[model samples]
Target: MGALEPNAALERLYRETGWTMRQLAQEINRVGTERGTPLKYQQPSVTQWLNGQLPKESARPVILEAFARRLLRPITHSEAGFPAPRRGSTPQPPTLDGLVDLGRQDMDPSRRGVLGVGLFSVALTIPGWPDAVGRMDAMRTDPKRRVGQAEIQSVKDMTDRLSDLDDDFGGRYARPMAAAFLVNTVAPYLKATASSETRKSMISAASLLCYLTGWMAVDEGAHGRAQEYYVKSLELAGASGDRMTYCHVLRGMSVQAANLGHGAPAVRLANAAAEASPDSGARMRAFMAGQQAHAYALAGEKTNALNSLREAERAVNQAESQGRRFGGFSSATLAYATAEVRHALGDPKGSVESLHDHFRLRDSTDRQRSKLIFSSLLAERQLQIGHLEAACTTWNTILDEYPAIHSGRIDGQVRRIPSLLSPYRSNPLARQIYERSRELSAK
Candidate 1:
């Protein structure tokens, strides 16, 4: 091949970012690691790319993502001077069609291995409200079928049942059922003709169900799959003019990012959710502020995190005084958020205190799965503070409940029990807990 010309397009974008070559390389490596594939690119590799040497196809996405995150906008392959993706310029399928396809693949056992490979991307392009609102393509209508309130209510009721099952049993047992329902039942309802009012309501209901499915996917440790479902939920929510669901889904995505320790993306997503929130009631404010506080804490904005926490506290108080509850956010939720903020801000003792408050204030509305996860967190934090006996007691509580929940997240916590106790094995209680954990994990 002839000697290649420099990639001036990429060089221009690089200049726009104000990132040194090494900084750019470091950013790419960070994104690669976030995508579950670590890289060790140095200035030399970035120099090659700027000099017109092509990066491997896998690395191209990481490079573009680094630029996108730096520029706070979407960066296309062509814009980054990379070859167009395989699908080239073809538009994505319409919302309903895409949802059906995604759900079908999720529910299919043979196709699940492929789905599992999708990595959570920190640079994933989040659709802004204006961009997503009413952006759905005209769906094909089945003239023979027209949905009414009955159909909408049926969908809502089914979502509630599925959610309850997820809270009680675990997403591992509930997600497949949800995916199958989405493909077989909800997909058909989306295509059915209906009055404009009924159509919008049906779509809104579908959006909630989609969001719940994504939440379950998160619980099952399917982060990439969860992100896809969340995007679809946002599209549906916006199409139906349901700002509430849209904001809720965005907040859920933020929580996922924060849990995964992607602080910047978590802050961005949480702020977007709070910004897009509709007419904020006290409870709504608390819901948004609580997540914002956690995200800000994770991003290391100490002042912002504390301010957000204070705001959430005031909102929760206001909501309680008014005997009003919206968005299922309560004092208990705020306490949990406080625990997260404390933990992120490097106060494990304070975090433990807040966790205790959380459980004390928790009502029946809290999911059993959350109880287990937070209990595990409490134990880990207890261990961190040199309270080995207290930590062992907490672990015993978790073990008592662990057998009933089949969550990938909870299972991960259980797997950590032995290692967490290994240093304290000389203590009888710690040794006993460690042995118990080994036996339970073996099953």
Candidate 2:
């Protein structure tokens, strides 16, 4: 009839088990999130629990489990003053409740729970290490929204427009807008009534949007949030049976992971993307292989990197042989990636040559941001190998390109110029360039 002295129980448990309040809170939050029941518990929350406050409804079972594991004994709800989700304890929420909660939590700026969580193994829960590769059983769900092609097409159009914004401007400018759209608009549609076919199509479109949003998070340097978006995108892809987008999101995740110096998991995600590429067209196949090469190179796997690069080249040639011109994965993209791959593998000369090839064989579709990215890579490689004057020349081009381009990644690239030229500050040419770069960055 009365709440037990949970303070005594929790204190004894922590004292005997050597669990700090912070550790207990972190474990509770971790397990809660893993089960789609996110809690904003902190170190103090455990102290509150020890002072006789029951944990949040979603976090109770996790607290019980954490204590149980430490005690090597099962902890009852009555003992912990926090019962598990059970029959009659509370009515089960809607099927979409967890997703809604995630969206809500993501929208809440105060919830900093997942912001610190970094890259995790992509193969953790995937059976046979395959879902990361896009191999998934079609998710079967009864439809509620009468989502038709119109809804799906609207989502696609918005995606394309937002993507253009991301390409032209910076993710810093677009990420919040996209997040608001997802939480305020798309989340509602996902729960509305629809036919089976329409639901799949809508989910497919939503998956791409999620991937795009994830990419924006990457551009904004929020790797943990990007990973969350990628995971959700993959889940939506599976529900829609859209293997191609699944592979693409996996590739996206791999790219950012590599950028963060997470080589092993990056390599695994890239290989899974490659395995998922069999059903893709030649251009996409080549793109996947190229990604694998980059991942391999980052992991310091020279032989594998070179082999994957060759495979990419073969796929590209096969596509060109059949008169298929690059759309998504163009020759310029491959050339620049190859350049990076070479640089990563310690081939500075080859990297420079590949950049040369990229420019020489450039396509009309090469956007302004693409040029700046590749040129930055060229300058970076040259600078890395002590070609000070050559790097300066490349910077002149980047400086000229800087005014016309407005992208976060481009801004980051331009800011690197001063640091790159810092060692040569006494040299008039380097000083002039550094001063000019700093001036431009200030504007």
Candidate 3:
């Protein structure tokens, strides 16, 4: 789907400069090297460019530098760029363009501030946007290459595999790779020819990948970028006419907002998810209820939080009756919500219980990164309960996994252990735990 020949602007501009394609490619590599990153563009990549190809975004600055040196003038992509599919008939050009630009922005080291901007583009969710999706037309493109179920299926399979990698390690492990996939593969595919049905299917698959990528960004502690991806994911889901997936992405955004202690926005977003959704499944309802509980708790609405928790429990019970155990609404989410609300409400003992329940849901093979967080919370709760010995014991478990969990969030958790156990410095067990934790922290 990628080798489209519409880069007329780039080809014509390069031809005007009268440099051989190989020479241009060499100059691009030299510029890239001076910029502290090695690029491997050769004659073939350049030949393909003349034949209609888009260069990688990361290669763009270097390419432009090489061109400007020959032509002796500044340039921009709009003047010397691969032409996107004409938007004259495509209903999805804007969305596809935004996503491609996002990937490109992420690739440029100097342009990183926008990606990390924590401000949610609340303007995107204006009053009529939900209904606005109805105006979109999916049957717009006519490409030389055909995209179908097979290509979309590949994306879904990749999403699943990358999800497992994210669960086991951390989001940083695959976050950039996922973004690269979106830029280098998915973007071009979206521009290819497909029927309405195929386009929606591909969009649906792409939305899932975006959501997973956002989830990893959260895991990477890049909350701003995470929200950015989630917003786009929601938009793609809406374009696909899939309310369930849209609500799912909304819920993910609510979680991050709540985690950031922005209570009002979190609650509002969660409620919006519920109101905007169609007839969601029991598990989804349960997940929503649980999310509401956490958001309310963050807002200091204890009574409302408790009621939400009760509603979530009922929803989960109903979901079990429907033979659903674990997907998005799995037990882990409920336990984590309970622990968070309990802790927020200053019920340390109950928080500890819920935290332990959450851990029980994970076996030995589960991600150690989460364990590091849950265990740290457990130890803190034990300290709050005045069980110094138990606190130290939990800290020991966290230390065991500390060396294996290479995450900034987990690092923050491990670094706070000494301060948390400071009161127990006189206790033998606490002293031993503190020394060990300090040793691990040093590593």
Native-referenced Cα lDDT, model 3: 0.73
1-443: candidate 1 lDDT, tens digit per residue? 89998999899999999989999999999987876779999999999999999898767767876886788544556666776644322222257656866786678645555766777999999778888877554543445468999999999999999999999989887888999888778877876788888888989999999999999888888899999999999999988999999999999999999999999999999999999998578888898899999999999999999999999999989888987654488878888999999999999999999999999998777889999999999999999999999999999999998999978799889999999999889999999999999999989
What value does the lDDT take at residue 61 in candidate 2?
Answer: 52
Two-way TM-score contest, 1 vs 3, winner = 1
- Candidate rank order under lDDT: 1, 3, 2
Candidate with better lDDT, 1 vs 2: 1
TM-score of each: 0.78, 0.71, 0.75
TM value for model 1: 0.78
lDDT of 3 at 85: 37
Model 2 spans with C-alpha error above 4 angstroms = 1-145, 278-280, 403-407
Best by lDDT: 1
Q: Write the per-residue lDDT of candidate 2 for residues 1-443, one digit (tens) a residue.
A: 77646567567767877877788777777766765667777887777778887766755656765675566544445555444344333322221233333444455434433542554444433322244323222222223235567877888888888888877666656665676667566655664467767776777787788888878767766666677778777777776777888888878888987776777888988887777654767788788988888899989999999898888888888898898756777677788779878888889989999998999888766666677777888888888878888888888878976886656577788888898889899988789889999999999
State which candidate has the highest TM-score: 1
- Expressed as tens digits, the lDDT of each residue in 110-217 for candidate 3 is 444455555544333522236536333643342335798889998888888878777766665667777877876676566557888888788888888888888877
Q: Please identify model 1 stretches exceeding 4 Å from their true place.
A: 1-93, 109-114
Better of 1 and 2 by TM-score: 1
Ranking by TM-score: 1, 3, 2
State the RMSD for candidate 2: 10.8
